[model samples]
Target chain A: MSQSVNDLRVTRSQRFIREALIDLIEERGFDALSVGEITARAMVSRATFYRHYRDKYDLVEQIYAEAMQALFGAIAVQETVHSPQIWVTFFDHVAEYDRLYGALLGEKGSPWFVRKMRTSLINLIKEFGRAAPQWQSDSAHPISLYPAEDDLIPDVIATMFVEAITWWLEHGKPFPPQEMARRGVALVGAIFKETSTW
Target chain B: MSQSVNDLRVTRSQRFIREALIDLIEERGFDALSVGEITARAMVSRATFYRHYRDKYDLVEQIYAEAMQALFGAIAVQETVHSPQIWVTFFDHVAEYDRLYGALLGEKGSPWFVRKMRTSLINLIKEFGRAAPQWQSDSAHPISLYPAEDDLIPDVIATMFVEAITWWLEHGKPFPPQEMARRGVALVGAIFKETSTW
Candidate 1:
């Protein structure tokens, strides 16, 4: 096969493994899953599975990280300012991978996944801080002044948002994506407005 | 022996196992630590350990539940209103079990423990809602107007709070307990405020 064809085959293999991993996890769970099952579902050999991914956790992380990039990339286009719509859009994107998120971040999900997501989110928030006027400027900054004990502005904000998503997933997504987006934005706002001392 | 002396023996046995579990978790981490080690450290037989706890996880959950009670109980006495101090006081209480929490909720923690903590916390938040006027009053209830979609008000709040503590523990308790309390209350407020349209 030509180089391009080989590259295409590699991409297809990766997608197959990732999708199989997702389906298996959603069906059974992340913890009880095995490589043989993933390979069987993907219609690939164990060697192919090993070549495409390091392990089940790595597969989960790969899917999660990609989904997050797309979700945030779409939102970042219109997110010059933080809006309630960001929650709406971000969650709507998540709902696209509903079962995947549920399996990886739910009651039986791993902390490794949460840790990866939080770190990714914190970076996004920091980028937002630099670009946004309110976060960037001394005068407009909302909660950046109390540097003695609260310099981790992005960490707190990212954690609050990520936890909100985790809670939404665990509770069966009680509200639709749009409503979740609305509640989510409000929830983030409440964290900011209710207690100023921190 | 008298009834009092029998009760004393039971108490002593329980303390030995609980303390041993904590010490072992702190010294190493929860996942690798075993029943054999816990028994050895506490100077109890495996049968005795089994008598008081179903497994290592049961022992961990028992400790967590007890800690939460003491933490919340202390706060409730001064908590006619839910103040930011509750966050401060709660984290301060958590500090007492620093290593155990690290083992159970940190990077090396288990999803089983997290699921248990989340469920317990959701209950606490529900209880808080029933008692708090803002959450109780039909007209005043923040998210309760849409009963079908919003029954999980306390669940989300409790999750956000729990996750924040998890992050704090993972990050080596950077802000100290009091400041953690303050930031925690603020983070919760922000969640409530920003996405109010929902």
Candidate 2:
């Protein structure tokens, strides 16, 4: 237990560094920034930064991995597989970090930023698939013919959701995060109509 | 007429370069590549490569942009608002380019690729929103109560779809493209419950 607490502390410190780097990258393009700049802006020693990452690129991966883990965890907790409330939970999750996500992912219009977001999202989707294996096989009444061996359904939904968020952020974050989540759930539901066993 | 032909030539050359790059990146890794190496592998002159793009990154952006354009165009044609066929079309479009996409995006596992994919997907979702304004205002049903103004429905769906494709690619392209599309459409349909409209 003590060792676990120490591990948690190390993880927290690493997250702090990554979040600070994301903040800096949002302020200035990733290409225009440097390792020293990130360390300085993050207020961590260069030694510490290197100890955690080989370079800015590697740090970007770590940041992405961390963010994805949190996002997936939230999604998993809210995983209803076919419930409207699942969306409600998702909206709540997005609302909590709209500002940070809006800036880092919605803005910055950089190739690197976009790339990181996609990889993280993909990772999250795979987790979702694993979590909801029955989703592909439980075709009951109205939702019959669930493709038991394909991954297409998840791909389309995931792509659509990310695109909507990007649109919201790029268009100046016109709506509240909850609203965004609600609408997202609705749209997803619309695209993938629900069915009951009866 | 001459100018159009010239434009075609330019487009073809660009496609060739991108295709070659995708192949090379798959065999090795992006980090192990350089402009000279890429140009050499593509069998194009360095001068021609520079004329088309400033560097390898520029070429990457070009590929991303073109791929996105293709994807959006395919979606626009479907205009399903609430149909399984729409999902089918989307799956077909993505599966067609499985090799190139799987290598650069699904398998490469690069942050840069992820960012590019996200940005492209988001742009496509925005296009979908613009094209399907009805989706923004339809509240006759309980699912529509979220109000498009504050919703992130499009983003969530887009993100899911893209991620699913990435998952498919990484997991060995298990299902036939059309079967994959059918499953995707059905899954999303159940989730959204928009069957009455269709």
How much lDDT does each candidate structure score? 0.67, 0.61
The C-alpha stretches of model 2 lying farther than 4 A from their native spots are A1-22, A40-53, A57-103, A109-198, B1-16, B29-32, B43-45, B61-96, B109-147, B168-177, B187-198
Model 2: per-residue Cα lDDT over B67-146, one tens digit each: 76887688678667444565566667767877767776655545566655655665545544454434424335534423
Across B1-198, the per-residue lDDT of candidate 1 in tens digits comes to: 245656877788888988887677667767778898999999989998887789998887778878888876887777454545555666887788777677787656775786677777776555554544443233433555335445455565665666677767776787778777766655544444333334
lDDT of candidate model 1 versus the reference: 0.67
Writing each residue's lDDT as its tens digit, candidate 1 over A89-151 gives 778887787777777776556656766777877776655444444332334444454453343
The global Cα lDDT (0 to 1) of model 2 is: 0.61
Fraction of true interface contacts that also occur in model 1 = 0.49
Instruction: State in Å the error of residue A124, model 2.
Output: 8.5
Relative to the real complex, the DockQ score for model 2 comes to 0.38
The DockQ of each candidate is 0.36, 0.38
Model 2 chain B scores worst on lDDT over the 10 consecutive residues at: B189-198
